[model samples]
Target: MASRRRLFILLAILALVVGIDTLERPLANPDEGRYSEISREMAASGDWITPRLNGLKYFEKPPLQYWATAVSFSLFGENEYTARFYTAFCGLLTLFATWFTMRRLTNNETALLATGVLLSSPYFMALGVIVTLDMGLTCWLTVALAGFLYAQSDGTSEPTRRRAMGVAWAGMALAVLSKGLIGIVFPAAAIFLHCLLHRDWTLLKRLAWGRGIAIFLAIAAPWFVMVSRANPEFAHFFFVHEHFERFLTTQHRRVEPAWYFVPILFFGVLPWMFTLPSVAAASWLAERERRSFPWRRFALLWAGFIFLFFSASGSKLPAYLLPVFPMLALVIGDWLARTEPRRIALYLLPVVVVIVIGLAIGWGAPERAKSAWTRDLYGTARPFIVAGGLVISLGIAGAAWLLRKGERVVPLAIVVLATLVFVDCVEDGYEMLSPRQSGRDAAAVTRQWVDPSTRIYSVNYYDQTFPFYLKREVTLVNYVDEFALGQASEPRRSLPTVAAFVEDWKRPGSAVAIMQPGLLEEVLKPAGLAMILIHADERRVVVRKP
Candidate 1:
């Protein structure tokens, strides 16, 4: 009972830390700003059916997260916290689901440890606070996996099995809503691979497909139906272009070597990466005795397959491998519960090496900066980076000493607290880089000069956070990068040429334009357009027609 109480307290503290950090940083573009603005527009426009960006139709991703965030905005009024609340909520919920699932599969000790592993993981915690579809997708995927495991686990009554399968189906449905087809595809493929390897055809027979399919369609189908009916172009764009082309081609411009996720998976788990071999061996050997179900093997298959899937994709990002981390936490948790402190102490050595490497990188970051402005920003951030590294190193050293003293539980606590501090420091440092990466400052300046009647033009580029910060859309001037589909459908929404934008700029009403400073000097100046510089930053220049 005391242990449970302590665990609950620790979790509550971690939750508070995560919640506070979500509000501390401005939204970083282009992903954070892009998603937040989409949600803001969704709330403002009251158009829940079709997702739009900058007041134009945007069907690049599904609308589940946008809906959740929109509802948050309506309740809290738009701000960084509200924009990120759903994602942070999902992250916490994912942690709870992981703990509950592991408790059902193994024991309370393993469950608690598993939850700790996930909470302390840098990548998992980082994504939880950042606005992105990845964490939302990871949350639902974890739920789906948990529900499936519960349904299949030994000693589950028939009624409980049916209900668990229902939960699994609903989770997949919500996953689809969160990020489209991969929600269903990943789980289905993992299950198939599991059954194929084990020759367990009976598990398939027990899946309750008739009821499951109904539940899945009931939750996932309405938005797809409504969006498709409202916009004819959604079907091909969402299904073929977004999923197929995104996976098979590099058209999204996110291509990387196939081994890209290899390092990500290694470092993403952090402090626990060294335990993988032991965890794998222990899980594999232990599952040999369980004839009823090989839960650990199934988890391994799930993580391995998904890692390989994203690694093989033509488009890749570090967050793409987030779904695998929950499964890893489970296996690693089980290993931690049974392993000795001496063996665990051995793992701390590699972590010290990582901390040293991190310090070196943090100190050298300013020197590697691309511009004088960014170099100054990096210089300002260097101390925070060093502080983060020092925090982790000291904690790891203390934890190692505790392990040598045969203390187990307190060492884990030290490490979790240390990692949280490290993450907090890194986030603080990241905010310092916001002057270059975010448009929040520019947006604030633009907000001072413009009213509802002012026409705003984004000439040649778009800073994703600007619209969210300003709470208004800018007209596009010869900018059709991600907005290509939106622009094609609504051609008049964007100005076609610089010459044409200059014509629009000559109109009588108050007008402001945002462009790179280089573009203003080389393009607009050469064209003899008269402008008053409103604000200029390292990344963007906001100007007004005079």
Candidate 2:
């Protein structure tokens, strides 16, 4: 089993390397992109003590991710790949952690499949490369949850169980450091829901959870104390603003409908999408032998809590539901191992076909396709195009065929995974071949435009990717009227309004402007400001005021 796990670990590392950014592009996405840039800045600034958001003192999340990324950047010189290395590293770790964690609760076949589902999931793949809090949270929670699962698996021996519990608590502490209290809270919720649903309350009674709590506090408290002490406002902002307000109030206005995660949960489990049905089928198949071991029951409860918990929040992003993937993967792994080949193939065929068709259409689409969709997809790769697609398609088809043959399952998984790795590498590598703003190169270009004397402004546009890649401070233009200056972070960097900068542009010799398409027509045209569109892409609008 350990040898099998080592092989899966090797495969997981390959999957991650496939997505690792080789070219530096400007950060284009938001939230994660921007937050990562800020964290990188804080890390590089030698200001390891106080967290800053966009050059201002901002304390939204704990410093663990920032510190990690900064350390990666220090070692790697801080580009998109380096900036995202921490998140991606967490993601990779989560893959290994999930494999071992599932193995504790179930069989080896289940563990292998579960880990595969997680490694190929949409949310996990994307978050792994971007500077996102979700991946960090996912990583820590997975580690903690793995401990939790081990605790349950070792129920026979008190000493073993307690030892597992200690690991669980320490992992929980790391998870909390990754996010906040939610690290422990979410897992606790999963445990409770599992017990209640299964009438396994006796399991909880033996957990000696208080000791676990103490372990969590011990590992997590120092950072909280140091940060709070360093930044006096840390406690209130960390708890009140970031925690409660982010959840209850729409002041951030990120609220979405309750069924929001429904799609994320489905697509986020990609590559393994076909196998999910088998999990449901397997649960039913095992319904008679339903063990007190909280595998399926825990998975169901875990997924439910993550979906509904985030749904109840005042804010939502597609990636917030990443925590639910591990449980879903567990269910998937368990089912795929036990299901009949014919039954399983019936479910997987469509998913494979759709991905291929999507890839084909995306690749053939013209430069002037004019469709907003697939404009930025991985299908239009200029790198190893034929070889990559062949490998990926073969993987999917071969995996399906293996399922049809009712094989021992390891070889098919390896084949399927071999293709997935090639695809990620080829797809991500192709961006380096094209003239587009993504990954980290775009950020490097933006960095050249910035000097101490040059004032930078985005013209009604913001690319989250820009910030992370540039590794420089920038202000996102929200509503840049004259009144907007007061809301700016720095009077020079920000303003009371757009008038302050617009007025400066009139006197500029070489001050730079980043403008979106058709953006300045209404705002600046009326003021007779002639701005030049310098750089343009699906992701960014760069302008220079001559």
Candidate 3:
């Protein structure tokens, strides 16, 4: 009863952390804006078949995330909280999924500990509320992984095994729909690697491949077939260009060092990092004492594959490492559930030292920035840092005292609460970065001047946040990144170059173009065009012709 109560309290705390201040800040550029804008269009147009962005057929990603966000918009009425609600829900889903899986593998204490570890991880919590497709993909991936792990155990009844395998297949399908081929590729590789390591050929036959494949095709195929049929170009662009080319070439210009994910894995799993090495080692050794299935080995293979896969990819992003975190949390959670409280406190000392150093470095950051906006952003962020640091320091002190008093769960609670404080601070400090990075304020200023007849053009550069905030599509003028294929098929709405846009500028009335500040002063200003600067910011400028 006490355990259940503690679990409920932890969940309630998570709900508060994920839900509060969701609308306190504007969406960040590129990823957040791009995704939220796509969902905005998806809901507004009521076109579930084709996923469009900036009023173009956007096939860069599958429509599952958009579908979720669109539904949230329908139920809640479009706003930042609504746009971000699904992602936060997915985060909660991941925690529950991890806890349930851990319970199946171990016990209630381990399950709760795993859930807390995941909930406390800074990157995991931050990504949960941010508007992005990664969380949805990560959640489904967690489902598939947990189900597979549960299925692999022979101690379960035949019915349970069958159900677990069914879940694995369904998860793989949803994952495919959520991202791409990787949904299937990642799990398949992990399963194959595990089977090879254990030399367990019988595991393959146990997977109920016939029923599973039917389930997979049923859930994952219809959209692909329909979208491909509607747009003949989707197959090649989505499969070859996005999947193959993105993996094989640096043409996307997202190249990073080969060891990029090394730090991501190390720091992304914070507070728990100090004990992970010892815990992971001890857990593996303990598993070897029994003749049970190699679940630990399978988890390592799962996380290791994701790390190695993205590490080898030509393009890399930090969030690509998200799928690996759940596995790490499970491992650490199991270890934490078994270890002594006082020893756990000893393991946390490194985290305290790191936090102190990070705060010191942050305190000096404002002086290093060149611009007033950047210095102010740093200055504004300092309070949140200090507040977070103070909360964590006190929490650590409390946790250590509780551990000395032999109060096991209280220490864990203190650590989790401290992590939540840091998460809140980060979320709150996000507003400081808004002016330079977000199009929210600029869009508000632009909205005052724009009317139904006013044509908006994104010239040379596109601020992803603009369309979502303005709640309308802006014409792209020589500015298609992933939209190139869409633009190629329908060139009517887009101008091919700045020269072409200048020519089109003479024929328009109340046409406002959003462009980079550099482009505005360099090209449009020298042209002596009758362009009136309507809205200006560090990153973008909105200009009108009088």
Q: How close is candidate 2 to the true structure, as a TM-score?
A: 0.82
lDDT of predicted model 1: 0.88
Q: After superposition, how far is residue 333 of candidate 1 from its true place, in Å?
A: 0.3
Give me the displacement of residue 290 in model 1, in angstroms: 2.7
lDDT of 3 by residue, 172-269 (tens): 99999888999999999988997787687777888988889999999999999999889999999999999999999999999999999987787776
Model 3: per-residue Cα lDDT at residue 528: 86
Which segments of candidate 1 are over 4 A away from where they belong? none
* Model 3, runs deviating above 4 Å: 1-4, 7-11
Candidate closest to the true structure, highest TM-score: 1
Tens-digit lDDT track of model 2 for 1-546 = 677667776776666556664324345455556567766777668988776655666666777888887788778775556766777678778888888887777767787877776665655665666567888888778787777677777345877778777887887788788778788888789888767766777877766678877887888898788877876766876799788988998876677888887767765665566555556656645754665574676667777788898989988887788888877877777776766766766665676676677667656544545655335443455445556555656676676677677763564455547556655655465554344545354545656666767666654555555655555555545544321322343445554356766776777566666655566666776787876665666545666665
Instruction: Answer with 1 or 2, whichever has the higher TM-score.
Output: 1
Task: Tell me, by lDDT, which candidate is best.
Answer: 1
- Per-residue lDDT for 312 in model 2? 91
- Candidate 1 lDDT over residue span 374-478, tens digit each: 899999888887998889888888888898888776787777888888888888888888888889899999998899899999999999999999999999998
